[model samples]
Target: MSGAYLEMRNITKTFYGVKALDDVNLSIKKNEIHALVGENGAGKSTLMNILSGVYPYGTYSGKIILDGQECIFKDIKDSERHGIAIIHQELALIPYLSIAENIFLGNEQASKGIIDWNKTILKADKILEKVGLREASDILVTNISVGKQQLVEIAKALAKEAKLIIFDEPTAALNEEESDNLLNLLLTLQESGVTSILISHKLNEVENVADSITILRDGKTIETLEKDVDDISEGRIIKGMVGRDIVDRYPKRDIDIGDIVFEVKDWTVCHPLQDDREIIKNVSFNLRRGEILGFAGLMGAGRTELAMSIFGKSYGSNISGHIYKAGKEIHLNNTTEAINNGIAYLTEDRKNYGLILINDIKDNITLTKLDKVAKKNIIDHNKEYVVAEEYRKKMNIKSSSVNQTVASLSGGNQQKVVLSKWIFAQPDILILDEPTRGIDVGAKYEIYTIMNKLVAEGKSIILISSELPELLGMCDRIYILNEGEIIEEVDRSRATQEYIMGCIMEHSKEGKK
Candidate 1:
């Protein structure tokens, strides 16, 4: 391979006359961990798609050079033959298949129309060892955790003899320890002389591992910063990304604490399939008017179960809970009743539960409350259009028009549409579960601003997040849940990452006793 491993020169791509990438140039050296950062819709994914042959050679104007030779990639298979592999943000693994089968799904171990199962298992074992995964080769991919699935992806790439691997938001769903392990694996790959192009929204992780950083804004290349030569700090990177300095990530708000507005008592939920196994245990909490109460916990700790159970029992089976609004008991048997009772839940899995991807922004925005746009069972198209446009602008959704399909929009914009759908319902209490899971920092700041604005208008928010720093920054009070139970509650002024974790550990030890 040449000293400069790959280069894309003057790449320009357009979609339906819209310039998705305009005169973008990028170069990467061999064995370096290069990072790409930008706001949503800034052409990061578009550039990578072109490189990986998702967009074929003639579809876009660009010159791709690898190992000092110009190349034309016809499809993803062509790029793979040239030692290129991409692991997307959403993993592409079949759940029912075993680890060995998943690793060699297309390129199987076969000889003369006969498959060699033994060879496949043996080879998969070796590849998994290279990726530092110790799982059995025959274990089903569905049975493994997300972090292990990520390693399996890397192992698959290595099986293809990939010299250059691209990771697109690989740690978006992983917890802190899982993220650390994945980053360390990247370092190990670098030591083995593998080149990596990391596309991530987490600025801190980028700053931690990247040898060089490239910034993109609005389909154009901003600048590339070398770690040893440039500033390369998180703040410096943010300026290059958003084109301006953001003074604070979390918006400032005055505390106007009011009386208790919503409460749940003795809430318990059982697993949907395993009826006897309790997923949530007798949890009680209260939210005041204009308050942002946060639930912090590790993965599978039942934070989501608690939120869903309270939101009309959308998740669990055999649920038992007493919900009170202004100290009066109320019953919410279904989702419509929950909304009618002034409660809205923005689910964590937006693509699955929170949005109808085939629908347009206007349809999604008015989905929860179509009655507002109708008079005597007759729809008002003009009124709907105006309302959708107003929210499209208010949420700063980056789309060509409100008629654009939700699936065509970026992750952040899709999230904004979900928020708009619920906010239009005018709920007194909003439950947001991991509201900023896969979006960029600029978009995260915008969401935080919206949260501040909502609470300022006397709306209560129940935020369930795996991110401790976020809870500490934006919440008025924080509750730590461990093993399906609330272990401790801490005020925002007194909550720290160390302290919350300490409480969980203490509770775990006592439970063991």
Candidate 2:
């Protein structure tokens, strides 16, 4: 703790009688990677938010000492001006803008109200090169992959000349390749004297990069371990985060693969906007009635697009696909038809596309199939409440009441609500797109258990996941997609990390030719 760059003493924050951070004290050395590890509600983000001025000076009780001086930030701009830049889990990129434009968006390189495009691009190029994204500065933000978007976010911080950069789950959406690139960039930044405070759930990544680790639980500081600590294993980190040893990170479930229940054939989907560009090319697969069929792919490999295109052509146009349910052909021209034909897609993006944040849990749960709770176009509040309560209990949605707004819940609870909404629709074929993205380990285990139960109940599931481990752990069979095509289909017993990645690399190389 000698010559620490930042220190928080007796930090305390509360919201509506709930303590977010209680007398938390932490210190970070200059040009060091400090990891903040905790469960979803463990107040890690709250503390970081306070430090970054999201909670502001008066809202939270804390004394933030930066570089041996007292600091009080009233807003985000104040924090940025103090060389503290935070890249949130949810990115704030404008899709229509170019990468250079987004990088220097608010703080443009301008003189007398005139933007210097040449200087802006040049500066953006320097930052992008620093982040190992030299070729992406000219591309539109929408044209890039999610992983590249994250690097762009870092570039934005670099353009601001930020010293104490905070990354909140920066690698949550990135694939292995992209995640490695970002981590290596962080290391490079550290070598060049950039201090980073990383908030992440991936303990392996944390252990790999962090110079020190701080664990928080129940709004209290648990312990801090230096990089040289002999007992700083992932298990120890999890114990500190959850306050208990997770005997099995993934729950035990007996696999029971039954007969085929859902099947797709000759599926070829073109890009929704560009007619000549194909996103899902002639992909064919089958899902057993009592099995989880995992779709594994790298980013931009068409996993989510294929699922969305199949779940009522939501992703692509000029689509030529045939879907069958229980050995009978079905037509799903829209989401309503897909639902009516016993197919439901739980979107990967819960906040933007899945849940109505302004609505209460009761309203969101019954949104998809309101016909069941309506009489002569008049809604039955009692029935809707009953339905919401049943699904809430079934999914273990942690909410005070059904009347609680969806926005107020944590990430894990919001995910549960999204699942509940689809589950109450009584779909026989459930297409789950990254269902466990950005949730905690405890909540992930619960979701895995829920999937097991659903399969046991003779419901077929199509799980699309970027994390290969998740697909390998949960699916009975996996389709390794690459460039909108099914390159390899392997049974769970046969699929390996090496095999999946090898297939993708091969496919990508062939596509290049």
Candidate 3:
């Protein structure tokens, strides 16, 4: 244990009498990529926060030994000063500020109340090159792509002289290429003698890059497997995380797809800020009753743009589209009109656009369909509680009670609340955008089962996902989108990962020509 670079002994944290981490123990080797994995609410984040001083030393019961010395970190700065840095899933950078400024936000290059801009830029340039980011240090963070933003986060850590770096779900938002680049960067960092701890749900990436793996379940350490010694498989890791063997990743559904229930024809939308730039280009698609239709694409392929523009024009401008329900054309100029006309959209960004974090689950569940629990604009508290409780049980949302704030719930449970709200609205056509993002395998299966039930009840679904396997397993038919246009459509029997990717590549090459 003395030879280990970092060690946490008997780490325990609680929230409102609930134990988040119960006497957890972890050991990390020097200059190795260690992976921490678990289901939602499994204390992965809790442990990392304690290590990085987000929760502070006094708030948690633990002995953090760094480089053979017991360290007590009072704040994030304290940990940073000790060569510890953390990069969260959400990149923490000021959008309007230059990369150089963001890298040294608090620890700026200043002397006697005067900032040295040249020094900051030069230092940032050196770190950015280390992280393989080619963008100029003076470039604004807002203008860079998400992939570059990830690199910027790592560069910031390097600037802090971090010897031990932790990344929480770094690849969750990135596409395949971006994810590969980030994972490779972690390996590169490891080769350069920097120790890394990656917490992710993507088992494939973990297996690829992790030198050792630690599994947590229900706030307790289950097991730690060394990649070189143990038979580390995705199935083994999943069983340790969920406490059961999931025979099937997707639930079986009785396919009984009916006639077309919703159709969009020659739909086109221009960018909101750039008038002449098209975001969705003459896209045409249809959803049949009792079927899940999936849209597959790489990042920025306009799947979200098409869904949002159709749902009361929530995105883009200069929209031109023809939407039909049950063979009758409908006009929806706003979100209210779209909802009233039996259209519901579940946004990918559940925290920002989907849920009211500060509000209780009951309030959020019944927010979309207030009329159901109200009489003449007056809400009945008793009825609302009953409705919320019903959905809580139905969705299997793990919380203390329906009155629990949405912010306090896990990512999976929060997504369930969003689904409950939309289901209560009684929409005929539901657009689910990245419905299972950032959740565990078990949670993903639960969501897939919910989709099956919804379609079984004759409700059509428009699913948009970046995961090719998810689309393949869940959709009856898959549409490939590239550069804001639909390139090909394939039936479930014909859609393979290779076929879908091939379509995208073919179309991309044509677009370039």
1-513 per-residue lDDT for model 2 (tens digits)? 358899999999986566778999999999999999887777888888888888899998879999999999999898998899999999999999999999999999999999999999888888888888857577899988888899999999988899999999999888787888999999999998889999988888998999999988878999999988657789888888887888886677777777888889999999887988988888898888788898888888888888888888888889997888889999999999999988999998899999999999999999999999999989999999999999888888866788889987778889999889888899998999999888777788889998889888888899998878888888888888888888888997899989999998888898889
Ranking by lDDT: 3, 1, 2
Clash list (residue pairs), candidate 2: none
Query: Model 1 residue 510 lDDT?
Result: 94
Clashes of 3: 0
Better of 1 and 2 by lDDT: 1
Quote the RMSD, in angstroms, for model 3: 1.2
Q: Which scores higher on lDDT, 2 or 3?
A: 3
Deviation of model 1 at 187, angstroms? 0.9
lDDT values of the candidates?
0.93, 0.88, 0.93
Q: Which residue pairs come into collision in candidate 3?
A: none
C-alpha RMSD of candidate 2: 1.9
Name the regions of candidate 2 deviating beyond 4 angstroms. Answer: 136-138
lDDT of 2: 0.88
Estimated TM-score for each candidate: 0.97, 0.95, 0.98
Pairs in steric clash, model 1: none
